[model samples]
Target: MERTYSVLVFGNEENDIMLILKFTDQKFQSLSDFLNSEVHNFYTHIQKELEAVVTGQKEESDFGGNMLNIDIGKEETEVYYQMDDESLGEPCFISTDELYKLVLEWKEMEEKMRRGEDIFPVILED
Candidate 1:
């Protein structure tokens, strides 16, 4: 089955920080599964690079050299990324620390949801 996903980047350039939130297609078995897998993939990739930097095998500056590339289904996926010109850096340049924080926040939200907590507030439609 084909699945869709969304990658949202939220932050300001003045602070040079961005938070990335990836939502898995609801068509999947469970949100937990999807989130777990996605987080695992990200962790694996980042861990490798982090280890390299720790071991002096790679330069710290090269850690987040590549742009954030997420694969989404053609018809089902949607992406939202916006940045003000005043922001100092591009979305592609989000730091590893920010990415790590995003993952942590994602996991925390998932846990809260599992406990039957509502993470999103109700929105009134016009």
Candidate 2:
């Protein structure tokens, strides 16, 4: 199956734009005001961890905490996301190859935004 990832812009007012990330059936959202904030850090951290897994620094590892947890494996990676405070949502598995590409795409989008490039409604399918 081809997995789809999208970045969408929302909100009614110019000052209220929100960034929405759609990954298959899941949606993660953030205020545009914080577009260059903590979320980027999380993505970068995950990217590094994924790289470590790819480079054989560790047999397996995990990234994220609290609302999200990614179990990184050699071939497959499990992504778990939760919006609620007390429970975790169902886990989804994607190939580590695809996850690496997705994270790189996200980091590229962030860089574009930082450079004042328009990146709304971006779609990545793999």
Candidate 3:
């Protein structure tokens, strides 16, 4: 019924929900730009991504797991994202750059996990 969008900015500190926006725009750059623009289409943006994932030709996504899995092709621009199931909150968009970095980091972490190195939290330490 309404528009909504979510921005998932990786935080180094705790106690931050990042910024989630919901609105419509004639000119919106990156998702960051859309969120930074104002506090507005929290649903519209999310539905957009959902449509891509849910209604896409692939019909399957590697969102979360033990390994790093993300691929955004030309026909289908995919990226990692998440939303709180309990919170019923807005969906967060994982920027392409961040997604790539996360994938690489997660791959390394997964390898370490397989080797039985340091496997505890799935946090990408900067």
Residue-pair clashes per candidate: 2, 0, 15
Q: Report the error of model 1 at residue 52, Å.
A: 7.6
Per-residue lDDT tens digits for candidate 3, residues 42-78, read 3333333334554454443433322112344323333
45-95, model 1: which lDDT tens digit per residue? Answer: 644543454455654522221323322221222111222332322223223
lDDT of each: 0.36, 0.57, 0.35
lDDT of 2 by residue, 1-126 (tens): 233323444666543433344544432222111123334557667778888988888789986654566788999987665454323335567777766776776667656644546656566554
Error of 3 at 1 (Å): 32
Query: What's the C-alpha lDDT at position 100 in model 2?
Result: 75
Model 3 residue 83 lDDT? 33
Candidate 1, residue 80: how far the Cα is off, in Å? 13
Query: Could you give me the TM-score of model 3 versus the true structure?
Result: 0.30
TM-score of 1: 0.32
RMSD of candidate 1 to the true fold?
16.2
